[model samples]
Target: MGKKRLVSLLLAAVMLLMAACSVNMGEDEPKTTTDPGTKGTETKSGAQKVVFWHAMGGATTKVVDQLVDNFNKSQDKIQVEAVYQGTYDDLLSKLKASMGTSEGPTVVQMYEIGSRFMIDSKLITPMQNFIDQDKWDVGQLEPNISGYYTFDDKLYSMPFNTSNPILYYNKDLFKEAGLDPENPPKTFEELKTAADKISKTGKAVGANFAIYGWFMEQFFANQGAEYVNNGNGRDDLATESLVNSEAGVKVMTWWKDLIDSKAANNLGRKTDDSKKAFSAGQVAMILDSTAALKGLVDGTAGKFEVGTGFLPKPADAKEGGVIVGGASLWMMNNRPDEEQKAAWEFIKFLTSPEQQAFWHINTGYFPITTKAYEQDSVKENLKKFPQFQTAIDQLHNTKLNRATQGAVMGVFPEARQIVEGAIEEVLNNKKTPKAALDDAAKEITSKIQEYNRTVK
Candidate 1:
């Protein structure tokens, strides 16, 4: 044959060999099938894998891992992977970055204030959807706790770690100051009196409240005050902030007065510092979440007796109650149907009475289900640390109302920072309580408007 013809035959033979190799490689590859309902790869065991992202850290992380393990072992249909995603703020930022991507979690634990934002983002499948489909009786959940996550008559998230603010005091200091250790202050005026006595007795600074905006919001709810207009954003979208209203002024004024009269210590803005002060016997009282009860009680063991009380309100204020605090589990819309279903199963398991009791005992968070109180572990826990009962009683006593339902705003996180700034200004004598709050309210209103515009 001619040289050109030989070269052409050689090239065609090489092409045929490459095609045969490709076919063999394709056959040798694992035969995999994707579920029509899922965009993810299935496990070899055929179990649907659910990715759970949580903001729990420290000791709580261990409990979360244990619960996930229990769920995985309970059945083999679904295998859940629980990931620690740092603090709530950090987790939220990471989630935002992962939006519209498959890298995001099937279920994410978002802080309570993020409800409005989550709803507005339209990135979540409302927990109510699953509840309705399954005909699940939501009445089993604590109304006060669930109310915070419900909007437009729909529950947007499953409450996991619910809590409320409470007054933590040193019983030893109360006795030393000639105050009734058994009868802790119930109102702001009474708290001031007790604080003054404690200060005068040279026991410790009467009280020290961290400049946490959540505390301000709780105080507003306790006094039947709305943090934002339009029925605390439940009746309709809030058009403006009510943080400078009469109720807001009352809280700020009391906080500032406590500092001015040397009845309380200005511990800046760190709740941790206030907690440390209280545990070390350097402060007679501090305001914190019920979740802090175990730590406070254990930390102060033998140093002093710890007393718990309902969050204090103004003596004349009525028709108010504490709003539920803490985070909830949200099902993401981007996840596949199978994955979402698996996530729902995991959520149910977490909120079940037994699991809730376990979680409540391990972590200081209140069990979202009322039935958890009936669990023997919970009963023994409450009896051992009676301070836990104070939180339960406070939650049950809270009146279900627009104000107590808590405010909803897409800019809630930002709004909280503004309120904290106002508190700092008032405490530092930079502005009067009313003036500072008014300024903060105006800024928050502007932010709300901006958020609304963007979401729209």
Candidate 2:
């Protein structure tokens, strides 16, 4: 053979061997791309983002965002986007519409009581499942607060902004009334007497309160009144509302006398308006949620030293329980496996004690995790600021009372409106407390009955 022909054959043989090797490597490795610029940080889900829906606003949002930022930076697994969806009602509406829809958020912040309905819907995964599946230590959480997102034997959500109401006072007004500013009102009578003295000052209203239904619920629980008939809103089988009972009526009557004797003023009942009234020195003492600490601090802004204490009890009020308030985080139903994994990762990140501490310290949301309270940073913050210390103290010995279990009647918010409307009538001198609550309770019963029928 000629030399040129032999060389050509050898070149073709080498080319064919190389092509065969390429085919085998392609089959074994599938396909993937690595950018040198990405610097070894895996995309985890490759640009996937999680949507978190919450009702937190103002400073609360700032606190939440900081936590979200921390989670994103800690790992690149998934990015979370939080949207303020008005109120819990508005979020419920969106959740109802999103059921089984593909466009909903992976996470939704729900009212603690309303979680019962969500649990029944089977539209979300229980947080306990995640904890166990991931081999998480439940002990890291505060025991009593665990049930905030739980129902029966399963937990459908994770406690986010859990809080309970407490008595907030204007210390300057307390001193003016010859009362010890540090020694706050301890019972309904003490509150009234201090209020009476403050009212006599002509500058301070004796007592201040907001949300009649919330007050009735809190006061009744404080008065040892059963809220639900069977076992005070504990059992799911409860068939009647006991809020219209003798104990309930008595508390309402006392509140009426405050208005009647002109020892107290409603001054228009809203959480914000009430805070403003108290901070501006229009009222001496206000019963509000410890969650209102931020607003109270902001409104006072060095105007007067403020003091905090647990909600006043009656001399005979139940000494052991106050129900939980605030909302929780829920994972929506039927997401893709990847999406579910991503969502669960995000949920775990947010519920961790470190994140809870960050939230509690910054936004006044009670730390859902126990470790947050025990942190040196949290302790330092509490000592540096009495406002923070008060809320912390309230939680130190709180009992998980069923009497204040929380309002779950579907039209509960509307029922509150009914009571507020009746309150207006009394505040306007159009009806007595008996007359007002009578009108209010009747409407509430109808609404409860109406909501009950729909649920069943």
Which candidate number has the best lDDT? 1
Question: lDDT of all the models against the reference?
Answer: 0.82, 0.65
Which digits, one per residue and each the tens of the lDDT, describe model 1 over residues 1-456?
553344233333322332332111000111222211222223428788898888777667778888888888788899888878766655666776675467999999988877776776667899999999999899999999899888889999999877888889999999999899999999999999999999998769999998888888889899888889988888888889999999989888898899989999898877778899999999998988888888889988988999999999999997798998888999988888888988999999988999999999998889999899999999999998998888999999999899899998877766777788889999999999999999999998987776666555
List TM-score per model, in order.
Answer: 0.90, 0.83
Q: With candidate 1 superimposed using the best TM-score fit, by how many Å does residue 263's alpha carbon deviate from the native? A: 0.9
Q: What is candidate 2's lDDT per residue for 1-456, written digit by digit as tens?
A: 443344233323322332232111000111212211111233356656777877665446656667777777788758777666655555566655564467688888876645545654556777777777889877776655665455565666777777777778888888888889999878778877888888998877987777445666666666656665555434663445565577666776677778777788876755667777888888877877766677687778779988888777777765554556777788766666577667788778877767877887776667877777777878876776677676666666656555544444434455555666766676677886677777777766765565455444
Question: Which residue pairs in candidate 2 have backbone atoms (N, alpha carbon, C) closer than 3 angstroms, thus clashing?
Answer: 195-206
Off by over 4 Å in 2: 1-48, 425-439
Best by TM-score: 1
> Over the full model, what C-alpha lDDT does candidate 2 score relative to the true structure?
0.65
lDDT, residue 382, candidate 2: 79
TM-score of 2: 0.83
Error of 2 at 363 (Å): 0.6
